[model samples]
Target: MLVLIGGAAGTIAFDLFGRAISPILGFASLNPIGLARGFLGTLGLPNSGAYGHLMHLLFVGLLAYPIGWLFVARPVFSRVLVGLHWAFASAAYGVGLWVFAIGGIAWFAGNPAFLGFAPIAWVALVAHVLYSVVTAATINYIERLQHAR
Candidate 1:
């Protein structure tokens, strides 16, 4: 549960940061946020709108908190949850990579000069990977706390 909550929180936090920085950095309005909406919609989930995006973030956070509590509340589930966390994290990373590649290619094709965005992409990718790692570590630590309790 900690894993889920952490995952959701991580997702929301990243989205918020991405939305805030995208325009400042001259990224397309549809870059990260649009990618998220499209991916969620593809999975038949609700897409985040300007207003609803905040709600969705809260929703994910709420769902994750309880799951975290559950895992923390039960010792036996800790290991299983941790394993699941890594599995999901891996999958999410893969999806993120796919989205980045597709979006980057499309953007570059339309604006050949957009290769200037390469440094931005590189920086963003590094930050993203770091975020994922931290989220995974947080989940793991939370699980350990649950087990220790």
Candidate 2:
């Protein structure tokens, strides 16, 4: 469905920024695969590279995160932040994801909390926002197309 497509698009954006753009810009890059692997390790699960790929790409990026955006985040924010644009709200959701996944989960995965507020943490922040923005844009575009039909 469109949701899945949006999610996949966003995930690709996240990876592109984290792996290519951030590093080229002199910031530490994000490795979602490693993070997923470490998180699985923390949970006493398989933590193989294959498993990490599945967890990050299939589960979190393509399913849970998008559902969270459409169901939980948008609804809550629309109510609380009347008149705020969806893109900004999506960016806020990205920040929340960074807090939960990076700040909190990464710690359990053995990285310093918030990367000890290091440069990488800021880079990660931008990546997260980019992910959400792309996701919202994709979904919006799809919906608008459908409505136009």
Candidate 3:
């Protein structure tokens, strides 16, 4: 439950920052919807902007990422580096996510790998780290609240 809440909050923050703040700050805008459409193309599927939006928002943002944080990242990191602060751990996880999604997955999605190491890539790195930190912070806060009861 906490993980879901955290993940949702984190996704919202990521979307908001990428869509609203980054462009206003003169950073390249993230086009997650277009990315999703490209991913579908890689799979030889017809592009549907609506489906792309749904997949990005519902599947990736709302479900897969949070579950990944809870089941994969937290468990492995906890045992490997005991007593590590959640913020640091989450930031590391965000870097990993950036590598997997931007560095690796970009190739399959027909984009230059690592966005050719461009400024947008840096912005993406920042966005990913922001997402992860927010997610972890939200989860930790909720857990503390529950324990305080």
Candidate 4:
């Protein structure tokens, strides 16, 4: 149960940080509502933006929790999981930064609407790293607890 909760928390933290950063980086329109609406439309659920958000959140929770539990149950696999986690996290951060830089450059190069929010982007990047680190630590701790039992 604790592992499940931790995974859910991690997923929420990750998505929250991503949402915050995307707007500030200018990669996404600042309107979350419109974004949600469009996302829902893509899934054939045209008037269910709220439901779409909920489903996305649920998907994250489901993916993370089982992965977390698996890591906890198999200590030998924990190291591999941690390595993959870092690789995945770094790739995500790198992509986000690249997108932000491109947008900033485009905006400065005469696309007046492409302005980037560097500060917010930086904050979001930091948040994502923090989240990954914390999740890794929590998984390690959980592994230890399981082993001790």
The collision pairs in model 2 are: none
lDDT (CA) for every model shown?
A: 0.48, 0.91, 0.86, 0.48
Q: Which ten residues in a row have the lowest lDDT in candidate 3?
A: 54-63
TM-score of 2: 0.96
Clashes of each: 4, 0, 0, 0
Question: Would you list the rank order by TM-score, best first?
Answer: 2, 3, 4, 1
> Candidate 2 on 36-102: residue-level lDDT in tens?
9999999999999999999999998899888999999989999999989999999999999899888
What shift in Å separates residue 85 of candidate 4 from its native position after superposition?
11
**Which candidate model has the greater TM-score, 2 or 4?**
2
Residues 87-143, model 3: lDDT tens digits = 899999999888987887777898999889988888888888888889888988998
**Once superposed on the true structure, which residue ranges of model 3 sit more than 4 Å away at CA?**
none
The alpha-carbon deviation from the true structure for residue 138 of candidate 4, after best TM-score superposition, in angstroms, is 1.9
Candidate number with greatest lDDT: 2
Which residue pairs show collisions in model 4? none
What number of backbone clashes does candidate 1 have, counting pairs of residues 3 or more apart or in separate chains? 4
